[model samples]
Target: MPANIVAQARGIVKSFGGEKPALGGVDLAVTPGKVTGLVGPDGAGKTTLIRILAGLMTPDAGEVSILGGSPAQRLDSIGYMPQRFGLYEDLTVRQNLLLYAELRGLPRDAQEAVFKRLLDFTDLARFQSRPAGKLSGGMKQKLGLACALVSTPPLLLLDEPGVGVDPISRRELWAMVAELTKEGIGVLWSTAYLDEAELCDSVYLLSEGELLFSGPPADLTGAIADRVISVTGFADRRRLALTKALDRDDVIDGTLQGRAIRLLIGEGHPVPDAAALDLGPDTKVAPTPARFEDGFIEKLGGGPEGTSKLAAAYREIPPSDAPAIEAKGLTRVFGAFTAAKDVSFTVPRGQAFGLLGPNGAGKSTTFKMLCGLLTPTSGTGSVAGFDLRRSAAQARSSLGYMAQKFSLYGDLSVGQNLDFFAGAYDLSGGDAREAIERVTQIFELEQHYKRNAGTLPLGFKQRLALACAVMHQPSVLFLDEPTSGVDPVMRREFWTHINGLVRRGVTVLVTTHFMDEAEYCDQVTLIYRSRQIASGPPDALKAQAGALTGAADPTMEDAFIALIDASDANRDEEAEAA
Candidate 1:
């Protein structure tokens, strides 16, 4: 091993059973003083590999090393932040950081210095005394990072650290990581976001537990030289039609971007005939540099990439004429605290409506009220025309809900859980059996059907939760952070399943922290501080926010951050004036 090498794994092979192999002969190396990204979709074995390196789990066959020693023997030299960092919400930010610092056996003076620097970097200095549970999703993520950095281990491994964090917080976290790298701490960061992969000094692309490519991001782009083109001017409808038409050709890979599309053609492949297109005269086509996403697509067979089949499925619900859910002047109060105040929204039939906000911005409270789990202190609402306040059960029966946590019977097998959910929905005999079979096959759960839910991986558990929520095939579906902590591959697959459900005419009301996932929604409602700050298509919201930031083209994340920051500034100024 090289002198700078902090972690190394050779010929790693892990299997859950005799049939399915999760990681196959994978070789990886992480160098000190650099950030190495482990990028892949869900079920790509990112977590499994990271777990092995962290000494949290053992590989069936592999040679693993950390800090020039065996991983198991050098556990104290590494700090790992799992997808779910197992944070204790009840603790204050300072308390959490202090606890982790103590666990790492840091000296009192050193711990204080580290804690102070972390607070400054994470911008959590003012919120140190606040309960972590009360912090926003983004803030919680910052705390998680702070806790991980408490000891300043030589090797830091992070698994999807930005999964549910807002754009501002995500950027801040990346900045911290970059600073750590400069300090000569070897960092291995795993994420599904291709855009994030570009920030790493080097990347290891994994697919279905197999290494697809390992090199600098620039090298990956160079491999697909001169193949990417950006085309604009087709509405989503025409874009979809065109994508389908172009997808028929084996040599092309296309992905939708706002009102435009990016196409990557195989080397020497003929370009599509422009005259054959139904494009407007304003349509513009230009060569564009291959991005990390482009490189990922090329490695993954270059199809219209973003979220996978599951993502598309989750995003594809048909348009609805009838109001599936309606909340009029909804308000929720806990003593002197007002969680949601005068929040109102309506979801048309078969539409995918998104609820977005900071962690304590009342998004979850509103979601619970809409689902009939929490009665609003003041308001009138209905789901599938059933009164939300008075007829909670009736409204709930017409809707399916999947909470943030994967809430399934851990002791039961996947099949047993599906059966239980089917029974809960009142499906019987053949109907229950058929529903179970269909969902299992669709989600590719057959391989793990007999496995206990507790024993399954995070992605599989998420799939099972989704399957259970939709077993009765309710007209309306409510998903709360369904993609949280999921790997990129699995997230894509999960969205594909969701899109399929939407095609069958299910109305989806989803609350998620993933800004990219917001784009997949037909319409989005941004809830900030118990109020609707913005509502519209992703493009429109982005455009409006772009007008303020002076960015000609603002991404969803950019728009969201701009809007929130602007809102907070306005609030602060108002308070000062008062």
Candidate 2:
């Protein structure tokens, strides 16, 4: 039923360097003036399909047509944005835009008009002169989007554009997308997030390089609408409840939302009653509608039915009795720009603390200082009782840091990367080898042991990065956008490991754009424009924002947006008073 098909593939099959063909007899279509989603988990051939559509790769046996001809011949008619934005770090925002515009051969007048429109919509006008390398992650994503939109091609291909972006930014980006679609520009969006697929006009579900299903998200979700059940309790109890619920044969998957747990019941298994399962003296359960994610999980074998055990044998607890991480008036400056201004916070031992903010807000700068990667301009901080300035090595020795970018030698095999990180953390000989083996099993990287780190899928890369960072088992863990680009099911499993470690006394300092992930943290801090604008428990933050916005029991996303709005209002008031 698609019209004006801008991109289409039939019986597509592709293989890579003598390996199994990533794509096998796949068929796809994208129409003008509509948003089409290519939804799949890691290693599902979504990337392979995108490559063929963009003429970056050839199909072993199939035909791909773009704008009625071969994809390679339609480069000027389509705009593409890969997962990695491919921006020149040294180039200024304006410079990058101009370069992309020139590459597309847009006239000078058309380029100026389009650039102005893009900067305005992306909210990057003020940062035009700033170097692309210096923009925050979220801002950088917007700039990438702007660059892709420069020529406004008839068709657009966006690959996971919202992977690590915050919900607010994601919404903003989608708003721009909606406008573009109305203008009759076709969009092919690839994503691992099932929830995002629901926004598309049509969705093609891929699994293991084959089409699992293709249709509207509503119809897909409706197929399993009768399976979901809602369970409620306080945060601590909710987590315990979910962990315990997994024991039931009927439970497929469960995700925690503040104090509530949404569980998917399996058709083949029998569900136990609440009273029989010890759901406290006061508890209730009711059937709820299924989400696209619930259906996706059901299709994928219900995911590790029994509990996935998470236990850490190594511990690096310091003898001194200071908080796990302490930053008092921490400040860091680059040239004339203050990346972190008067930031102070304390993460107690065994607590999971989340650092959140818009791009370019200094969260990474603050994280670097605490992890000993960068020195603070002023103030003092310590990790596990080791002063960052006086005992920088000691401080870092007690902590593990996973950077936003998967920082590992791409050419090196997974085993080599893990071994290297283990050595870097001072683990060598049999101990390092054993540690590598343990993490390989725990992180589910056994099959990819001999594969090059870069050659593995995005999800596998994330697993490798986490494995390398945690190989030494530091008492304090610093995770930056750790779950970015991971599918929902894997994301749940990843959090299970984090929570399990927290139970065993590992303190976590994490930065993430996923508000749901923030609920897992014991505390949340929102940093804006290089300052800590707000900090508290998730519920408390929501309650305060709810009080002002009249939103009853607001979700974390709602609360987060309200807090930013309030901060902006305060600035306006101060300026008016002056």
Candidate 3:
């Protein structure tokens, strides 16, 4: 190992009674004052490697060194924050910090200084007295990071710390980590987010259990530079165009960005012109900058092929003039705090609607109210033309819901879970068996039919959740962060099914923190601080933000941040005027 390397691993391998090893002959190094990104899909050995590096798990075979010493002997020199950080919900932020200080064996005299520095670093000083449970998702993440830094270890291990966090909070978290790295702390950031990898000093791309690529993200991104392009003039049929592009032999991957279709052509293929894609004569194709995700998908042998079979089996709903979903003056109050106030939106027969906002925003609360999971303190809503308050049961029966977290029975086998869901949806006998078989084939779950749901990879779990949610083929679907924390390829596959459903006249209402995902929605309503701030098509929102940011073209994330900042400024001005 080099003297400058903070941590090193050679030929590390691990297995958990599976036919394949969890980690196979992996090698990596982390150096001071730099971020080493551990990037991979689910079941790619990232967590296993991080656990071994943290001395929490022993690798079956490998030589691991931390701070120039064995991991077991250098435990005090590394700080590890796992996926679910251990934070006592009842404890105050200060109390949690003090607890971690004690666990790290810091002296009482040194606790106050360390706590103060971490609180300031994370910008959580003012909220130190608040209970951890009361904090927003982003604030909780910051407090977790602060606890991990109480001992000020030289090496920091973060395992998907940005998962489920909004763009604003994600940027803040990254900024905090960057500051720590400036103090010579080495950071190993493991994440499914490729954009986050683009920010690292260097990245290690892992697939299955082996190392696929290691070096600067730009190296991989540059490999596909000439093959990336964006196409316009699809008008309102962009989703259909994207679907068509993904089926092409030359197109490796494609996604909807505002009103444009971003495509990555296959290697050795010529840059696709508008005519080559069977697009209209007015369609314009122009070369675009390649992204790390473009390279990641290319390296993964391209994303799922063809259209979704699951969508093919969907039966179109009967024609109706009524909106599929409607919410008017909906409000929910918890004691003195209002979670959602005067939130309103409407989704047509087959449109994909999005609810987007920062953590602790009223988006989820409003979503729950529409889903009939929570009763609003005032106002009314409806789904599939059924009143949410007067006909809640009928409204619920007309919809399918996939929660933010996988809500399937983990202890049950894949087949068992499918059967249970089918029965719950009133599917029985031949119908139940047919529905289960259909989902099993479409989701490629036949091989894992007997496996425990809990042991499946994250991607498979998401697929199963969707399968369970849609087996009965309800007229409307409610998805809460359906693609959170999944790899890019998996997300694309999930959206394929969703778009297919939308095309079949199945309305979808989704809430997500991923701004890119929001672009897929026909219309989006952004809720901030329990009030609707913006509602329009993705391109319109981006145009509004582009004018504000003075950018020729602005991304959904750029628009999201700009809109929120503008809103806060207006609120401040209103307060000053008063």
Candidate 4:
């Protein structure tokens, strides 16, 4: 007996002008009322397959059935959200909904009810009159989602639904997804965040255009549950232990989590005892449970922790006596709106400094001022020891910047973009050719050089953007939410390149929503409502916030939320007093 399948694909194959096909003989099925996850590395064919399911593109060789009918026939009954949802920013939220509703041919009676339900569920009712362009990043994403759901289709195809959203908004979006499935609407969700995959009823793992495995998320990781282990060594010997562990063929992957090293070993591989690595008698070793990430990384051949030799503090910048970055009483304004207010901070040589805040919290304004893209309305700032106001050209040349959007030339091939950026650094002929070759290999962009920058998967685009930004190896690097839509596996690899740069004495200032990634920073500065809220080491900030919240120990995410809540409460009290 066949299970109740809402959508199915067999022998799916697709090619996008490459030696390798985008999808190679893949298979998948969607069950009623269940969320099916499609996850894989960038260019693993997730988007290609989703397009096929949505009837936007046809597979070169295969069969696809949506609701047990030809995909074309069921197009009206399906709701699809692309990675970059094309919401008309100039239109008001309600206007956008009206457009989608009209397209679905919903009568006035149905349209009113659909609008009410979508607005309520997405919590966009209050902002329905606001122009979509005026909304925060998170709000815009929610409005886009509401537009997709306005039709109340029986099936949903969402590609990376939570991209670039903060954790709280991300949770809210997932909650909405869960409710849709409860109404017996089958959903196919593709996500870069592997943790989200665990929430799906079932998952299909893709890699290099083929299905590697398909089953419950736990089943994928739990098979090697006993192989995951934690090894504790003295702080002095931790690096040595990591080197030795990674040198072994059995050690699949390892990372420094807190004070201990967590290892994901292959099946049948013995746990790495500390004594084997020449650690003192005080070393502790214990088995740890495997996670979906462990299995995913292992299956994908994720090896040895990634860190860049050039970016990981391998060498010191010559003649580096001044601080890498300095900001003093910086302020920016647009008419009556104050985007950044009296912000001040500093980053010394060879340090990884993190800047974090929620959407529209003045982060972008402040970043722009520091990058010379926008002049501060008042006060001053400097990058790479050059005053942004007085020496803008030197400051610009002394640093590399990667905007949150990846800021690549959409129409250019990967090689062309690299060549253009390389030219900006004054490299040409043999020098430009050498730099391009080096970065292409370093970032594993050799195969993607011919691909259009904008057409690559989000993860691959992230790698290319970073490669282009660092082609000149500037002394200071500013990355704004660089991992917004990337997966956990790729994030780790991206940081390997960053850490390598830090080691080479390059100064780094990064903004990110992933608080866990903030743990890698030497210091973190928190901003809220255009003002600096807190600044210090990651652990210290968390502990202080934990004390205030009455939690003995709080994770970074919890501490961040606590700070925002506390700060808002204080501001309210102050307003009442005034």
Candidate 5:
């Protein structure tokens, strides 16, 4: 290992009695004052490699070095944060700090200074007395990061620390990590978000236990620069154009960006012509800058194309002029704290609707009310033309829901789980067998049908969850952060299936932290501080924020952050006036 390298791994390999090794002859390095990103899809051996490097697990074969010592020998000099950070929920912020400080072997005399610095750095000084469980998602993440830095370790390992964090909080977390790197701390960040990978000083792209690429993010993106382009003038048919383009042999990948279809074509192909793609003649194609995700998907053999078999099996509901979903003055209160206040929205049949918000912003509370998982403290909601308060069971029966976390039975086999969910949905005998057979074949789960759901890869688990949700083929679907930790390619696959369902007259109400995914919605309501801040179509909202930001093209993320900032400023001004 070089003197500048803080940690190094050579020929690392590990397997868990599977046909493929978890990590096969992988090599990686971390240097001082730099962020080295581990970028890959779920089940890409990232967690396994990180565990081996953290000394928590031993590799079958490998040479490792950490700060001039073995990973196991230098445990005290490394800060490691796993995907599910261990924060004591009952403990107050200060108490959590004290406990971590003690665990890190910090002397009592030195604790106060360290604790104060962490609290100030993480912006948690005012919340020191509050229990960890009472904090928002972003605050909890910051506290976890603070705990890992208690001893000021030389190297830090973060495994998907920004999974469910909103754009604003994600940027805040990145800012903190960036500050640490400036102080000569080496960091290894594992993430499924390719945009984060693009910001790293260097990146190790892994897939299926192999190192696909390793270097500056720009280098990978540069490979596809000439082949990338954005097609405009598709108008309202942009989604249809994107689906059509991706199905072509020349087009390697395509996604809707605002009103344009961003595409990645195969090498040696000329720039796509509008007529060639069956788009109207007014459509214009212009070469666009390639992004890290563009390259990532291209390398993964492109995203899924064509309509979903699962969606094709769906049965359309009867036509109705009434909104498919309606929430009128819905409010929920826990004690004196209002989780959702007078929230309202309407979704037409076959339309994709989005509910977006920051952490602890009442979106989830509103979602739960619509899902029939929680009764609103006041107000009313309806699903599929059925009143929620009066016909909760009928409304629930008309919808399919995929929770934020995997909600299927982990102990059961994939086939068993399918059987169970089918039965629960009232499908029995011929109906149960048909639905099971349909999902298994459509989702490509036959290979793992007998395997336990718990042992399946993250991507496979997600597939199983979605399959179970759609077993009954309900008229409405509720997806809560459906692709929270999934890679770009897998996310695209899921959305493609969703789009197919929408075209078949199935209403979709989804909530996601990924702003890019929000662009797919026909209508969106942005909630903050338990109230609606903005409600409109995606392009209209983007245009509204663009007017304030003075940008020609503002992305969904830009609009989201701008709206929140504006909302905060207004609240601050009101407080000052009072």
Candidate 6:
């Protein structure tokens, strides 16, 4: 073993039921005093590899070691946070931290000091007394991270720690990871977000249980240096059509961003002749720095294949004339507490509208009302041309909904679940069969149709949920954090389906903690403290957020932080002036 290596795996192999190989001859190494990121799309064996390293599961074959010892035997020296961090929601934040501290065998005095430091680092001091169940999604993620950090182990394994966390919270968590690495704690972080890979000192790119690339982020880009270009005017139909027409070559890997497309061309590949394409005279093409996303997509062989049709189809949906979904003076109060106040918004037909806010910002409450699952305390609303309060069933009939958790029956087969949903929507016999077949193909669920739902992987479960939701071909779709625990590749695939649905005139209303996902929406409504604060396209929001943070080229993450910070500063100023 290398002297600085904290953990090492050689030729690891794992299989389930002797047929499905989860990890195939995988090799990984985690060094001490650095953050090593494992980046890959869903079903890429990230979680399986992490589990093997954490000693939670045994690999079918391979050598695994931690701190120069077998991970199973040296489990006490490592801290593991699985995708689901086994948090006891019933416990208070303090209690949860204390429980983990004790389990890790810290003395009372040491536990107190560690607990205080973790709470301060996670910024949960104000919510120490709150039940873990009551914490917002971001806060819960912080709490999970805090619990994992309680023992302060030298080797930390985190599986998608920032999956469903807000940008601010994600930043804080990464900061904590950096701090730990500085203290000589080895961290193996698994994430689907390519942006997060940039923060790591080293990264291992995994796909289909194979290691594609492993090195520093800088090295990854340097290897493909000067091969990326930013092409503007992608929003123009003619230009977009031309770009897609030329995308069949293996040399080009293009990804759309708003009105622009970032094309990753192979080294020495000739640039397209702008004049030949009839692109506008003002069409601007410039070399742009390669982001982690670009590098990952390029390495993965030109973004996901067979997804362009979905993208193009979604773009064809006409903007709604009347609001496909709307809330008018919607208010939800619990005794003396008000969850939502006068929240009103109009989601145009076929548009991808997003509702974003901190946990408990009344997003879920508003979503429930929009879905007709919960009636507003005082307000009138309509969805799909049906009154939310009086014609909920009619409204529901036109909408498809996927909840945060995998809500399908565990004991049933995937085909059975789909059949049940189809029948519930009143599609029978041949119609139901056709709907099932279409959705199965769309989600690539044909192979897993006969498999038990409970035995599927996280990504598969998410796919199944989406498949079920769309089985009825509803005109509107409501997704509540649908990609929360999915891997990046799977996340991209999921969005491809969403875009396809939208292009076919299906309105989508989604709420999510991932800020990057927020960028994909046609319009966004940002809620804070039960009130709508900012609403617009992501670019508009970014321009509106000026000079409030670290960099001038503020990303959606940076913009969100700045917006929230500015709101708080204004509140503080008002309080002082009073």
Residues 104-203, candidate 2: write the lDDT tens digits.
8889878878888989989999999999998866788889888888888888988888887777788787888899999999999998766679899999
Q: Which structure among the candidates has the greatest lDDT?
A: 3
Alpha-carbon RMSD, each predicted model? 3.8, 2.7, 1.1, 3.1, 1.3, 2.9
The ten-residue window of minimal lDDT in model 5 covers 306-315
Question: Candidates' lDDT values, in order?
Answer: 0.80, 0.83, 0.92, 0.83, 0.91, 0.80
TM-score of 6: 0.91
| Model 5 agreement with the true structure over 384-477: per-residue lDDT tens digits | 9899999999999999999998888999999999999998899999999999999998889999999999988778888999999999999999
User: How does model 5 fare in lDDT?
Assistant: 0.91
Error of 1 at 391 (Å): 2.8
Kindly provide the TM-score of model 3 when superposed on the true structure, using C-alpha atoms: 0.98
Ranking by TM-score: 3, 5, 2, 6, 4, 1
* Reference-based lDDT, residue 345, model 5: 85
Q: What is the lDDT of residue 150 in candidate 1?
A: 83
- Clashing pairs in model 2? 15-21, 136-360
Cα-based lDDT at residue 33, candidate 4 = 95
TM-score of each: 0.87, 0.92, 0.98, 0.90, 0.98, 0.91
Model 5 lDDT at residue 129: 99
Mind giving the per-residue lDDT tens digits that candidate 4 earns over 1-578?
14588899999999988889999999999888999999987778899999999999999999999877878999887888888857898999999999998888888888888898899998999999999999987787788778878777888998887777766677788889889998988899998777788889999999899898899998998877888888885664444455556656787777655355677777776766767645568888888777787888878886545435444423367757788999999999999999999999989998889888888888888888999999999989999888999999999998889999979898999999999999988889997988898888877888889999998878889889888888877888999989887766778776666666776678889988887777667788888999999998877888888888989767677778888888999999999999
Per residue, candidate 1 scores C-alpha lDDT tens digits across 1-578 of 78879899999999877456889989999998999999987778899999999998888997998876887788778988888757889999999999998888888878778888999988999999999988887788888888888877899999888887756767888888888888999999998777889989999999888999999999998877687776776554533433353445533455445556666767666555444444565566777778777678767764533223443334334555778889899999999989999988888886678898876889889999998888899998899889986788888888888988878999999999998899888899998988888788767899999999998877889989988998777889999999887755456555555554555567789988778777768788888888888888888999988888999878888878888888889999999999
Candidate 6 structure quality by residue, lDDT tens digits, 12-44? 998876465888888888998999999987778
Candidate 5, superposed: residue stretches over 4 Å from native:
none
